[model samples]
Each structure stands twice: as C-alpha cells, then as structure tokens.
Target: MDHKGTIVMQKYELGRLLGQGSFAKVYHARCVETGQSVAIKVVDKAKVRKAGIMDHIEREISVMRRVRHPNVVHLYEVMATKSKIYFVMEYARGGELFRKVEANGRLPEDVGRKYFVQLIDAVEFCHGRGVCHRDLKPENILLDEDGGIKVSDFGLSGVAECRGADGLLHTTCGTPAYVAPEIIGRSGYDGAGVDVWSCGVVLFVLLAGYLPFHDTNVMEMYRKISRGEYRFPSWFSPKLKKLISRMLDPNPSSRISIAKIKGSSWFKAGKEGEPVKVTSDGDEARRLLKMNAFDIISLSDGLDLSKLFETESCLDKGCRIMSRKPVAVIVSRLERGARAAKMRVSKKDGGLIELESRDGVLAIEAEISVVTPVLHLVEVRRRYGEAAEYEKVLNEVIRPRLVDKAPSSLLRHQHSLSPSSGARL
Candidate 1:
C-alpha cells in the first residue's frame, strides 16, 4: 500500500523499527531540523480496511487525546498520507516490559504496589471523565526513562458510560490471556470491571512472576476465571492476597470499583512506608497554627496596615487610636493550575516563600492528628475573635487563586516537577 506524494520520507529520518503491531509498524524517527526523537506509528490504510479496523483506529486516537494523565503517553501529532496514517508520539527511553521484567526476573513487592496504584489512579481519572480502557496488559504499558509506566494503546478502549448493558465490550477486544472471564464468557459486562480484572491479573503476574490462570486450553483458562480461583505466593502480604481475590471476582457486580480500590486496606498498607511530612520549616508550623479572621480593610497587599489601624477610633468616642488585627494570609494549593499555590510570605531563604491563609479557609494536605488544632471548630471560632468576616472572605475569595496561572494575581511560579496539572484559574 505505497502511495508517494511530495511529502519527503527523509523528513522523518526513520532510524529503526521500534515494534511491529498487527495493524501498524512503529519506528524511532528523528526530525532532520530539530534532531528530536519521536515514535511514529504508521498504519497502512489498505491493511486497516482489509481488517475493517478503521473504527478502532479512529477511537484509539480519540481516546488517547481525551485522556491527560501523568502516567499516559502524550500524542504530539498525527498525519495521513495517501496510503499511511502516522501517529507521532513522545519517545520514551525506557524499553518494553518484555525486556524490563526479563531483566528483573520479578518486581519487588513495593515496586509492584507503586506501579499498581499509579495504574489505578490513571484509570480512575479516565472513569471520572467517562472513559474506560477496555484492554490493559503488560505489553500495552510503556515505561519512561525513570521506569514510570505510561499506559498506551487505547484502540480497544471504550466509553464506560456509553457501553451497552450486555457489557461484552461489544468488540470482543483485548489480549486472550488478560481478558476477563465475563468478557470471554460472552456475558455482558461493564468495561470498567474488565479493566480492574486485568489489573488484578497484572498484580498477580508481578508478585508471583507468573500468570494466575494459564493453560494451553482456552477453556481451562475460562473455567478458572469463571470460578475465580487463584492462589497467593507464601511471600505475598495478606492484604495483597485479599485484594486480588476481590478484584478477580467472577461476578462483575461484586468486583471492586477503582475509586474504592484505593481505600482498600491493601492499597493503604503501602502508604505506611512514611509518616507524611507536610512542612519544610518551623515557619510553616507557626503559619499553619495561627489562623483567624482579620479585619481586612484593603484588597491590595501593599495597603498601609499602620494607617488603616490608626483610623479605627471613629466608632469609639474616647479612644483616639484603634488597632485592627492583621490579615493572616496563608497560601495553599490553587486548583487553576493545580500547582502548590501559596502566598509567598518572605524571600529570606532565597526561595519561593508562601504562607497559608491563617483562617483554615484554603487547605492543608494533612491528617486530623497532625492538623487537629486548625480544624477544631471551637478553637477556630475562639481564635477568630472579632475577625470572623476575614475567615469568610479567605474561604470565599483570597485563598482560591493564590497560585493560579492565567490572569492570577498570585506570585508567578510554576512547578517544574509536576507541570501537567497546571491550568488557568
């Protein structure tokens, strides 16, 4: 299916074949001008038409564009010539799971746990936005140079809410080994359920270094999946063993949902590796500790506090001078760019300094035991004194956009570490 146009193949400068799929051939390509490496998946139109896979290919690209997650591949550009469709994607330096797992023999339990949680988190984001990745397998997950897994290949993915009641994925897609029993049995099943089931299988593979239900006979694999029988390695934690059991449940209705999956004891068990340290300094402790409504007399940070405080004697006949409580500005994460939005209080450390609005109106990513003092309603009221209105405004106004990106008055700062979540407020 070769169609030649004025478009130059040398422009792409294909280096080597990255991998070959049933429908497409991917290559490591470089831009002649910029010298940037990219993965280009070329799908032959004739082959696509022969297999009647145009719809799947269309949906695959559509799904990939809609999903924006830290652990998902980013598609840079797509182009089509007379005979070939090209998908240009970010090049990941890390190799395939086939080689990665082969090198490690088996992944460590903690390592498996981290990847599993990230996988679920990405899926949860998809479900939240009404999409479901119907096919999830080790081969479909690509890793970056840092060993971070980026889920790819959305060709078999479908919208979870739009799926028919028959739940059979309507397409009979996904790998044979990772297919949920419900899917293989032709029972209508939710798309989300099947994905979770596959995740369970992946977990099993990670922990035991083998597939839970494998047989040369397809019928035997189905029987095991239908019966939902699987065993744990003796070395596996009880929590993990129990989690996989629930997730691989034969009944879709009984299968765990991704949102609730995180709250599961097994998922929470891994978090015990560290006590959360939310602060980097004593200033953070004192700033988070004292929060009260102040009589905020101005919208500008440069408003003369001394001058404003000196003018409070009009209501008091005897008092010549009146004192106003200073506004306690505590900066916290603003949703606009989804960065750690904060109010920069001081530049003493030669770094970005932000203060949390004293009135707990913003947020603290802390548990009750550590953040109890600020959250105590009675204490908040008592500490608020006569400045309750300041608390109301802090919650309603000033604290919302402390670090927003577009059209924000907050300090100009963007996170280099986690830049994906930033959005305009």
Candidate 2:
C-alpha cells in the first residue's frame, strides 16, 4: 500500500523505498495476487516532463523490450496513472554488485571471472539486438539471490536505429571514469566498441579493486584514459594480463571483440571452456512491443490528441502527423519518398519503418498506428543527427507523403476505444 493506504493499481503492495533519483524512485513491492517480490520504479510524470527526459524513459522502455536474458534485469510490465509511471521489474535480492566489491575488496580470480562471463553473456545478447548500454558500471550491475549477475539501468542505452548515416553513435554520455576514450574525443564512435571499452574498465575494477585510470584531478584522469595508461598488478596471471591489455587497447578498432574475449584462454580457464549461448524469443518480444489500451492511453495523454500532437520544446524529440489514407498506402508513399531521397527504408514489426540517409547524416523511425478506420497517426522521431537535418528530411520526404491535415476530434474520442476496438495496426 502507498501512503494513502491503497494497493498500487490493486495489484502491487508497495513496500519501503529502495532508491531514488531526481525524477524517479524504486520501491520494493509484492504482487497481491502471487506474493512475488518485485521492484517498482516509480517515475513522476510531471517531473520527467518538466525535465524533458521523457525521451530517455521511452528509449529505456524500447531497449528493455528488445532484450531478454537471464543475466539482465527483466521488465515485467509498465503501468501509469495521471501522476506517475511504474515499471514493474524483477527484484534482485542480492542488491548492487558494487556493494559486494566495496565490502570485500578484490574478488578471487575465479569468482571475478564467473561474474565477468555472465556480464559478457548479457552484454552480447544486448548487442545482438542492437542495444548498447552506454552506462556499464558496477553500480548499474545487480546481483540475483544466488549472487549471479543481473545487469540493470538502461537509461543511457542506444539502439542501432540511433546510429547516424555514418553508422556510428554520436552521443558522448557515460560516467567519466568508465567512459570510452573515443567518446571523450567527441568523434563518432561505435556503440559496441564503447561498451567493450567500459566492460574492460569494469573487469579491471573487479580484479584490482580500483579504477585503472585514476587521478586527483579529473582532467589528469581523462588524459590517462586517453593514453590508455594503466598497469596490471604484479599478481595478475599472464593470460589475464594479456586479455585485459587487449580489452583496454587505446585503439577502438584493435580492441578485443566479445567473441574473441570468450575465446581467450583466461576466459575459458577453470570453466567449461565453451562460450555461453544466449537466445531470445523473437515472436514474444515483438508481441510485447504492441501497445495495449492502457499503454496507448498512458503515452497519448489519456487520448488527448492535442497534447500528443502539440509541438515539443525540442523538435528533434518527435512529431505526430495524421493521415487519412490507409496504412498500406501511407507506407507505400513513405518508401517511395525515402527512395527518391536516396535513403534506405526498412520495415519492422508494429508498423515501424526506419529511414537512413545514404550519406549517413540522419536516421529516423516512423511508426504508423490506426487512430480510426479512416485515420492513421504517423509518429516520426529522429534517432540520430542534427535537428536541422531531420527537419529537412521530414519536409522533403515524410511530410509531403504522410501528412494529410491537422488531427481531428476523432482522436480525442479514441479514449473510448479498446485495443481491439480499433487502435491497432
């Protein structure tokens, strides 16, 4: 129950607060029906909106939906009311991995390797699905009841759709201590490469009980990171040293890949020697991506079309255009426009289509949803590149092909429709 003494959604019994941030709080909760423990991340909608971080929440949801692995924290479902959004997730009773390391100092080689292998397995699964957890650090990694790894916190994650025309991620966001050197340089960087670099830093911390690049001054630490200036402890085994060296290579191109890391002698020592295979249910994942009635209502501001279509403070975040044409016709027109503009178009599940420029300057994702039998709402959002470039593409390609006119009252009445009533593609 909450402070009001009412169960959350009549489903979860909220417990003590576990953690909090500027806009969100995590609570320990139990299912009223099953008595199963779970973590509920309660996000204040007003605060998030005021901070203009709704995009981060949306991206986190998208990334979590795409990834499912034993070592990754699971998102059971999302719930929202007028004031708050709740993320019901798996509860890791063992708590943050950082706590364990902090209390016990450096872990034994075998123990550290076990956790690292699990971390890599989970990371590999995410990368396979084109999701990169930009912030990979000890605190973000949780531990299950059995002390196994459960990676969490994906607010900074990026997906392949976010790559620019250059086929690289441009955002430089991560903890300074664990940030990749290339990201510090402010040049375009591969998502997977930056993740690998952070993983290397994590490994060093696990074995050495200290950051590889550290200095009293922040600038000095960054210089050390840029130079890849770090030394292994004398106690580190030859194989471990070699593997860490390759992983911490200053050159992103030469940095060890996940597959190569798995094949390394140190990684396979005292173990089964075979790489773990992580697989996901594609059909189920796609199904989960579909917006239910509740989700639609939550995202669309209780079916208020005006609020949904209103210009955002930042135009690069997204925009909605209503179309009178059929879904098939809209898609056809979009593809034609993309081709004419020398952009590549790829269709995805749930009426999502991706457009990427040949010059690698911009990438956008457009999702079409049925607002009514005769009306469709197409949401176009930039995944990468400058707002000006995205706007140019929107004007030259998307707007001409998809925008029919301003949205009508029909959308405002959509609150009465069920998921099966019409609001699906």
Candidate 3:
C-alpha cells in the first residue's frame, strides 16, 4: 500500500506486486513488527472456492509444513479472514532462477553444478519426508542473495497418502516439457520417479541453456519426452552425460535414484575436500537436535489446517534406529562395521559418518543424535549409490552392530524457505 493505495494488512505493509496467477497475487511486504522483508501471497478465497481447488490450497499448506529444508522455500505463517488467505514467506532477493538462464544462454559447469547439488539435496529431503514436488522447473526455483537455490511452488505437490491402492500416484499434473513419460501414458506412476525425471530435465536445461526436448508443437514435445529423445551438446562432459542419461531413462524403475546421483563422480567432484565437523559428545549432539517453537507447531495436529481436508499420513522414507550405547561406542562400531563391509569410512562434522565403496558407486551417511538421557538415534541415509547396495550394507553390516531396539521416531530439523511463485505453467 505504500504507493498503490491497496489496503494493507495489519501485520504487513504490502509493497510492489511480485507476480500473480488465476486466483492469487504475490506482493513484496515488510513485517510491521520486525521490519524483516517477506513475500506475502494474497489469495482470493471466493475464487479458489468457486474453482473447487480448496483441496489444493490445503494440501500445499500441509506439504510446506512437513518439509523444512535449506534449498526449499519456507512458509513463515498463514493467516486468513472471511474472504482472503495470506501466505507470509521468505523473500529471495536474487529473483527467479529462470531469469538467470533466460539472460545467460548457458551457465558454466561449476555454476550449474552448484545449483544442481543444492536442488538434489532439497528434493531428496522432501522425498524423505514423504512429499513429492510434481512441478519442478527453473521458473519455480528461486535464488537467494548468496545465489543458492530455493525451490518454490508447492500447489502441484503430492504427499504419500495421495497414492492409490496400486502404490502409485494417479494424478497427471506437471509442465509438458518436464512431465515424465509414465505420466503421459495416463497410467499410475511413482511420485518420486516423476520428480527425478523433472530434475534431470532441469539439469539439462541448466547446462545446455535449452530444454532437452523442444518443438513448436506441444504434443510433439511431449512425444519426444515419451520416447526419451534428447541429445547432449558437444560441451557436456562424459561423466555428466552418463549421469543425465540414467536420470532421463524412460523406464521409471531403471532410472537412477537420488542416491546414485550423489555418488556419481561428477557430483562428488564438486564436494571433495569440503570440511565436515565431527562430534563425539552426546550432550552436544542432543543440543543440535533441539526443537524450536515453529517446529513444535509443525508437529501439532491441532494446529494443522490440512487435517480438516485430509488425514495426515505418518510415512517417512528415512531409516532410523535407536541405541543405548554411548556416542563413542556407536561411532567405533560403525567404523569397524563399515571397514568390514569393504567401505572407506570417514567422519564428518555433526556426528556424521560417511561410508563409500572402493569403486565410488555407493555412499551412505550415518548421523548420531542423542534422543534422550539414555536413548540415542542413529539415522542412516544414502547420500549416493544403488538402493539395493545400500540396503545390503545396512542389513549385513551396520544394523547388526547397533543395540537396543525401539520404534523409530521422526527426525526434527529446521530448513530455510523461499518465496512462492504465484504463476503456474
């Protein structure tokens, strides 16, 4: 309302219009109390109700609340009156990642790798929390002041509960260029698999400065996607080509997973020599897992609006085990077990232990956190490599060594968020 004369909300002073869509408009705003900049998405309740998309709004809110990661956009809070709903979110000063690609025909390999790494990390985190972003494109990825990624636009996201009895997500939703081949078949598809396909497209666009599949005719472009037709430019490295090829595989089951992507030589090349902090103190590790007020609110069913629309599922893909052993004892056992399994073991900061195969085809990370005075949680996740190989190692080597069995609980972590992209393709 500073210059446009639009009536501003009591908590925020609306500034310039950032963007808009069919039923919502996003505006730059500042908190009246803290003066912190934020993006406020103003939605017309009547319009969404008329369009019968109240479910979409509710789902978006639910998914955002569940996912809190650094590379993804954050939803600060939601406020609603009789006619409007406002989504207060983080303000990304660097604007849309699409604009960067639009201005620069192609990005340097290092720059593209940097963004791709962040993108994969964030996407993997969402998948771990049982959420899949159905729409992933440069337009939906924003850049923060430090030029890091902040993935936005969750209106098309699907949670685990959205899957049918066939164990596949049925809804066909995504941009034509980025849509997976299975989605085009009108058959059920795994939500995670489709997201991986879109990520491959994004990586291709980032490096080549153009879509892998393109045609003036929309149907033709989709046909290209369905046929798995795409070519690499002359400048693409052999390693990059190999990785992308696996990612773009037409067969969803054969397509490379986020784990394998992390283990790829090209991906690891950028991460080599990065310092990782390691801690053996149980008290310190527990302090790191401590929750804040917002986290408490996110975990509360009474405060979640999505519950009104649908029952929330407790499905999580991450693997966790409880142990009564001391931090040092657990770390020692993990190192011994990893070495026995023919893996190269290394310690990283934050009580993380990294295990990698000799051929560099598989990598797994184990993190230790003190859950209580007597209980410690060891969360094991595949950073990169084949899923089968990871499972084999976990079952044969790591799990046998850890003691004290208890039901696995959710891991609490806080992540940054980005502005909402009101527009949709």
Give the per-residue lDDT digits (tens) of candidate 2, residues 153-259.
99999876677767788998999999999999999999888889899999999988999999989899999999999989988899998998888888999999999
Model 3 agreement with the true structure over 1-425: per-residue lDDT tens digits: 33343444566888898999998999898888888989988888788878978878877876786566778888887766656778878899999999999899989999999999989988988887667999999999999999999999899998755666455788989999999999999999988889999999999999999999999999998889988998899999999999999999999989999999999999988777866534346545565356444433343322335332233422222355667798889989998998898989997643468888888877777767555566566767666566688779988899888845543233222112111221110
The TM-scores of all predictions, comma-separated, are 0.62, 0.72, 0.70
Using lDDT, rank the candidates from best to worst.
2, 3, 1
lDDT of 1 by residue, 1-57 (tens): 332222234466676777887879878888777888888888777788788767567
Give me candidate 1's TM-score against the actual structure: 0.62
The residue pairs that clash in candidate 3, if any, are 73-417, 73-418, 74-417, 74-418, 259-384, 259-385, 276-349, 277-348, 277-349, 278-349
Best by TM-score: 2
Where is model 3 more than 4 Å wrong at Cα? 1-9, 277-295, 304-425
Better of 1 and 2 by TM-score: 2
Worst 10 residues of 1 by lDDT: 314-323
1 or 3, which is superior by TM-score? 3
Candidate 2 TM-score to native: 0.72
Q: Which candidate would rank higher by lDDT, 1 or 3?
A: 3
Q: Is candidate 2 or 3 superior in TM-score?
A: 2
At residue 416, give the lDDT of candidate 2.
64
